[model samples]
Target chain A: MSADLSIVRGKQTLGQRILGFFSRSVVNIILIVVAIFWLIPSVGLFLSSLRTVGDSSSSGWWTIFLEPTRITLENYANLLSNPTITGSFWNTIVIAVPTTILVVLIGSLAGYAFAWMEFPGRDWLLIAVIVLLAVPIQVALIPLAQMFGAIGIFGSVLGVILFHIAFGLPFAIFLMRNFFMQIPSELLEAARLDGASDLRIFFTVVLPLGLPAVASLAIFQFLWTWNDMLVALLFSNSQSQPLTVAIQSQLRQFGANIDVLSTGAFISMIIPLIVFFAFQRYFVQALLAGSQR
Target chain B: MTQTVVTPAARETGRGDADRLSRRSRRRAILIALAFLAPALVILGALVVYPIVYTLVRSLFDASGSTFVGPENYIEMFRRESTFTAIRNNVIWVIVAPVACTVLGLVFAVLMDKIRWSTAFKLIIFMPMAISMLAAGVIFRMMFQESPQLGVVNAGVVAVHDIFVDEAAYPGANIRPDSGFAKISGAIVSDDAVNDGSTVDVPLIGIRADSLPDDVVNAQTAAPARAGEITGTVWLDFVRGGGGVNGVIDSSEAGLEGIRVEAVDNAGNVVASATTDAEGRYTITDLEPGEYVIALPPSNFDQGYQGVSWLGEAFITGVIILSYVWIWAGFAMIMIASGLSAIDRSLQEAARMDGANEWQVFRRITAPLLSPVIVVVFVTLIINVLKIFDLVYVIPPGVSKPAANVIAVEMWTVSFGGGNDQGLGSALALLLLLLVLPSMIINVRRFREERSR
Candidate 1:
């Protein structure tokens, strides 16, 4: 990539050219080294999962290249059959899917309300949601858990999903509201002018335009729920533990199990990876969504 | 012509407003908003607000789990030497981790700009972040595991010694058989005393122990561990041994006559922990350690009894800031970088034409312009960090370290872990809310400012 750089100057002086050449080479080398440094641990993890237990235990993962003939898939095979891990993976999906759907669903509706609906105390409600944004999840866990217990959702996947949705909605609504508000008032005015209801204007003109924000929200909420363990652990019973909780349980009291732990970690990574890649563009926007200009 | 068009238009608009039921509709809109917002508001209020209030109330109580001893708990918490240690450690964690991560992340992002495989690199660094905190804890535990070189890190150490140290000196390089953090020299003895002044036999556990030849074991005699020489890093070895598959060589086996385990909470005050079982496992409950969450009670009517657990509620208060920072800083950095990159090339060119140097151009032109982005980043980071949870809960084991803990994890521990002290948890949670609510206010003000602009 550095080799394809566009030169800064059309006609460079002698000293300038010399400095540029040295600077570029040094910068390129540093960048390459950094990229490798940043990536090595995760790559090492991937490779460790792929290799046989014996190989992983004996040498540094870097040493595997020297003994290319020793690679095996036994660890992955064992991971697949591991009942706890597989169940957790399934549980994670059940939790993440619903949580994402609800956050997006409720958030968009609330977004619509804040954007178009001319209600008294509308600004106050939006502020309240914004205020609610800072209610640390930790603070809510106990009471929320107790609430779930009373409602018969404690130790259930639904309970976990509901908790995630509740926490996720404030930010989700903020994101979606901003996006919806960006639509020119004239557009909605036009729709209403043609005898369309507010609901129809929302479903037709606004939602289509809010796709970018919605897509980003879905990606974030999905990843957040998918990766969440604290809520799941607190809310879900052992039978319904998410992949993170399950993976944590697989952590042997003594030390990490290379075979099981790596496989479990990789399994957890699969969905997040898929989500990120599938919505790569949205990922960028979502990363910057909540910040002010 | 103008009057005819204007009069009809006015009437039509008024008719439209009346048909839509302006006054009645306004009331209806309020009702609809209340209905729509009721679920989230009620839930947040119940779960978040109540617990924080409960925790504050509970912190005033005596350890017997009853009695309101106003400011006594806080006084006692501060009086303990260990409390000071915990506070220091937490301060270190807060100062070190975030700043380090942010700076490192910024540097990486800058270097990664326009690089090949930048996305791939980012995923790898971020991979640790995606894994559960509990999982990361376990992974680090494994890496730091001590054994007969059974843990990856120790194994590497042993390998390095095998290559560098003479074979005679490397008798049992893999096995750090001593308990605590010290090495004691004695003859390896089986069943009784071996007064040998030279070789010591330590029956090492873990895989590395398996490699020790029987001859070495027979030749070596066990020795008493020397005092005063044990160091902190060596203590890490003992801690590592405690968790690894390889059992730590018991202090008794080393002929240490008496050993007592004294545990301290983050406040550094000694707290009673459950005695270790025959298998050496100890479970400590009500250890107000680590991060926690604070929330209101589940239902509005039940707010009479706020919920707060000592450890659970308190931990939540500590972590609220940290978790928020981790989540929002990524965007802050990205936006900050983008804003920097977006400056017009012509501006820099114009500066250069005026004989200004690059540094001056950046300081004068770039930074001032980027102020808006920086302010945005700061506000966003403050709000986000205030709400942080998972990272705090997942990183530290609250049982051993309390002071270093955050509010979120503490709340969880207090609420769910054996301490069902919901009232105190609620109080602490409310404290967290107090900290976080200001950010929301700032955000709203900013939103209004932008809208007006």
Candidate 2:
């Protein structure tokens, strides 16, 4: 009886161990599968741009590994030489950079005023800006286009840039104000006591401390402006059309020109990828700090 | 610090607070604001504020760029099929896309968070968010190609059938012998035509197959010959062999022989479809009251039934809601997660020691603390949804084909897509502004309240 009981006990222990191992193994496998599922479409998109049009149409992008000889860089080369899309790459940078910088600078200042200063109609003015936030761009386009045309900036790069900056301000202001409010008012008072002018104190104290918020705002505005197509379409002229517009024009309804489309799309998307990665740490930090009271 | 800074400015504009305001200091503030904000304000007022006013005024007028017709546009909008259809599609997009995007994004985020290279995974999933909507639309369009298999998807399906199906398995299959519908080889009969087989025998060989209608034969033969040239067995063999016959299948295949015709009503169908032509929209010809689906052309069968249902308005709501939720969910989750993480660790530890379970502790302690975060997330999501444009314009479902189109897309359609319907567009824009005024007020008021705390 004792011998039989010992054997049964041993078998039960082994069974339990196997169950635990398989359960954990299944979880790890699932995690990996999920990761691959998320990555495959993007990888497919990237690979499709590098392949010849025949191969792209003939098989799934994953099939490239089965016939690696089909890989080609001709698509990218063609895209670069394509006249219709060339200038928009540079135009996007020119537009995104200045707009991002201006939004950061002006937003921080306005945010400071809202956070620390006690003035009449301060709440009212801020409210007005916030209300503007909910107003969809479509509602504003026709009138704004007319207004821009009247002012002679319609269909111009400057006009597009101005629109992005204006739209970007409310969110920027809201975010920066939240950041400034968290700085412990005593710190600002300490800086003021050091005999610094408001300008000096602002440059020295408020600005430096708001770096995370500034960084995140810059990243947000950069992504928003860089990826923007509707605003660019509505406002930009041929000379000032951004990469989104250029990429858009490549899409022919009946014609299947995957070569130029994928290549141009990749080029257009690269800047945002770089910006996102470079400032990624700041994204998490700012999201944690700026979001909460 | 406050005293030291206040002393200089206070003395300079001493009682300037009350009216000791010197021209220099007041002018300085004005100039500074002008330098910093004038451009933005002017641009905003001109582009955003003014257009909205224009849209409002325009919507009240007639289509000829003429005088105020006062809600006539709205009435016409209700009356017009296109406007109503557009509205219906927009609503479907808004309702469906947001929830779908949000649910998918959250599931992805949660699943991805468990992975070792979480950020890398995020970058990949978020890749689509970076690509222009036009590109996505085009890519999906190619993925949905139709018959004859131009698209990869259809090609793949056809390739499977070729590999699996035996050539001789179904000699009596429903497939037509020729390209035309009339020449089907199966036993099925159409309402319009009946077969009356009459044999004409030829003296030299046998009954000639060419004497019959052209639809019955593969439409590649050069011309018909005299009767009694070939036996029935030989003709049947010829039909099967033509496909795999001597290197030239085209030579032996007959054209337009053995033809039949069928007539059916063409009512209740989406006869024509379009893509956004520079203005970013496509509409099918007026569909009858029935289940109709119109996907992007060239690849029609790739996606599942994205059916446009009855009362197109519901579908438009679905689309709008989908887009709204999809775009805003990430922001919502991020805010809520941040809020939850901000809770004091000690409170939880103390509660655990007091025999409180995780659920009780979360409900009692964490819920109250997270309220502020929840509010911000909800408010931001609402305001953002109110203003979002790209997805709405890009992936319009069935309903938004007409009048129920969102204020934003409506304005664009009227001004741009409607071909110089600027006045109507401007008037709609103004109505949109009025619609969003409440959210804006709430956002600003919340900002103040949050700041004070």
Candidate 3:
């Protein structure tokens, strides 16, 4: 895309080039300023996490540059010492992993069916998936909570994981089905000529071809489940609540325990940031897929 | 003659075999699709579909789920103060947050052009999109703290303020009963200023002993003012635990040391000004005073910067919205930036060549091109903030949570956050769903449009 954008500039005169240079420089400067503006708050949180609660409360995080000696991992140490928070940190992993795995796994199979198979009621079913894409999770919260309670998975990590995957499937299937449609029908015909069974074809041809979309879907679902607060809050027991819920529970109105907040927030933030940077292209690809909640 | 070669019965048999084959394939396909979709659909049905249907039905019933109440819960939802406040805040959020975010996103997206590290620049700007709204909420709440010692913003407010004006000498200081002064409106004034060559004992009380500045000592009467001048003592007249006299500064009494004394004339103009020293003493030398009110000015009672109450009723919604904007603007920016990247550059170049400034090119060519993505981002944010449970629930302290509630948060609160009225909660949830439905529909339509294109 940028290659095409760069190609738009051609056969420029000296004056035009110079004017363009200045304009480009101005754009660079503006973008740099906006980037800095955006980075400062998170940087502040990071810096605060490195300092004592007392030091953090007394002065701005920006001042840490002048007093570099004040930085410590005391907050992180304190967070590790607390059982509830550390428990929830582990619970975050327990919840997010299965949800991501199941969504991608189940979504791809369903996506292949919708995209490739000449099944009855296919178009109407696809439309159903599309319409379901817009159903706000708020509409489902109360009754699901009630239903979960009735069936006794209400406060369990399984309940939370199941809830995330359910809500997560529409977009996953949507993305996967769309991506799968791009594969040519000739490939499927070639496989069928050799008398390949449907499951056999799905496992061999469809799943392998669907990896890029699957990767995108996995990260999207993982991040959603990892960063989730509402579902975890509603469904998880105190013991099973994820890090986000834990961090939220620790927030105080006054005399905010900044140490816990800064450290716990950092702890909760680590996985998503790691996954984002690790799978940057996939993340953006999935974002462009634009079925995210 | 060629058509008469086959019998009608044979033709019917052949046609029946083909029909059976297609039917068998169709059934097989349906079975495969069911296998693939059944898990996702089952969970979706149990968690998403069934719950949605149940909420609609549940909302028509009473809290216990036994009685059919028929819209009473909907009326009751609005009648409750917290739920009503939540609706009001949701309306404000729906209007303000999306526009603010989309505009910011558009500006950032447009401005990101022609830069070499534009990608890196956007990576940083879009970084917050990776952050959980819960974390973002905590960050902003800390930033908007009310105390200069705590909140970065109020600290900034104090830092900027301290640059222009000096802080108060004695916060929460006031005049005592036995002092030769009485409180007049806010400022303390003496009946008469001392004549030249006389010492005025302007004793003070009511200040805490420990609150006195460390440099302060026992009050001592000053030597008589030189001719045409006045000198006085403004010591704390009362001693700790009742040891000193009320009218005069005893040896044990610490000075009411930091009071600002102003001598006001008949015209209410300050004739002289002095701040008391460590010994609770001040001298206005070279005073040609026939009469003056020796006033303790209001500066003495100054209660240094009490930072804004961020969670207070007036600004809680704004603070919550600000946090919402913080977390989401990055999302809007990244999506819009991608859209910007895909825009046809020649149109913009053409506009530029035709005497268009950057703004004009953006307005005429770039903006209209980017409007589709911008509207999608806007409507997406509208859908997001409508179900804005996390930030509102997490950001505001418990005390301010009610005032900062959105409909989603209200639904949670009524059912589970201690209100214990699931029926009202179901109604509130339905209201949020209805409120969000239009934007959701718009978003879905936009998605379909994008796909179709």
Measured by DockQ, the strongest candidate is: 3
DockQ for each model: 0.28, 0.33, 0.59
Which regions of candidate 3 fall more than 4 Å away from where they truly are? A1-26, A253-256, B1-13, B163-303, B443-453
Error of 3 at A60 (Å): 3.8
DockQ of candidate 3 relative to the true structure = 0.59
Ranking by TM-score: 3, 1, 2
Model 1, which residues run further than 4 Å from truth? Answer: A1-8, A52-58, A291-293, B1-21, B25-87, B109-332, B378-404, B418-420
The superposed Cα distance between candidate 3 and the true structure at residue B394, in angstroms, equals 1.3
Q: Rate residue B18 of model 2 by lDDT.
A: 50
What is candidate 3's lDDT per residue for A1-293, written digit by digit as tens? 56754665665677988998898787777777777767767887888889887887677677789999888988888889889988998999999999999999888888888888877787767767776776778778877777788899999999898888888888888899888898988999999999998789888998898788889889888888899999888899898999998887777533547888888888888888888878877877887776536
lDDT of 3 by residue, B1-453 (tens): 222334466557778557556656767777877887887778777778788889999999887889999989988887888878888888898899999998888787777765667678767766777779888887887788776766777777777876676443555556666556677777778866555566677765556554455556787777678776677887767766677666766888776565677766678887777777777788876566466667887767666666678877788889888877777777888889889879877787778768798778877888888887887787678777788878887777767777887888878878887788888888887887787677666756765676689
What TM-score did chain B of candidate 3 earn? 0.73
Highest lDDT, which number?
3
In model 2, which runs have C-alpha deviations exceeding 4 angstroms?
A1-33, A57-60, A284-293, B1-47, B64-66, B105-117, B144-333, B343-388, B392-407, B434-445, B448-453
Candidate 2's residue-wise lDDT over A128-153, tens digit each?
A: 66666666777667666767888999
Candidate-wise lDDT, in order = 0.57, 0.57, 0.79
- Give fnat, all candidates: 0.39, 0.42, 0.68
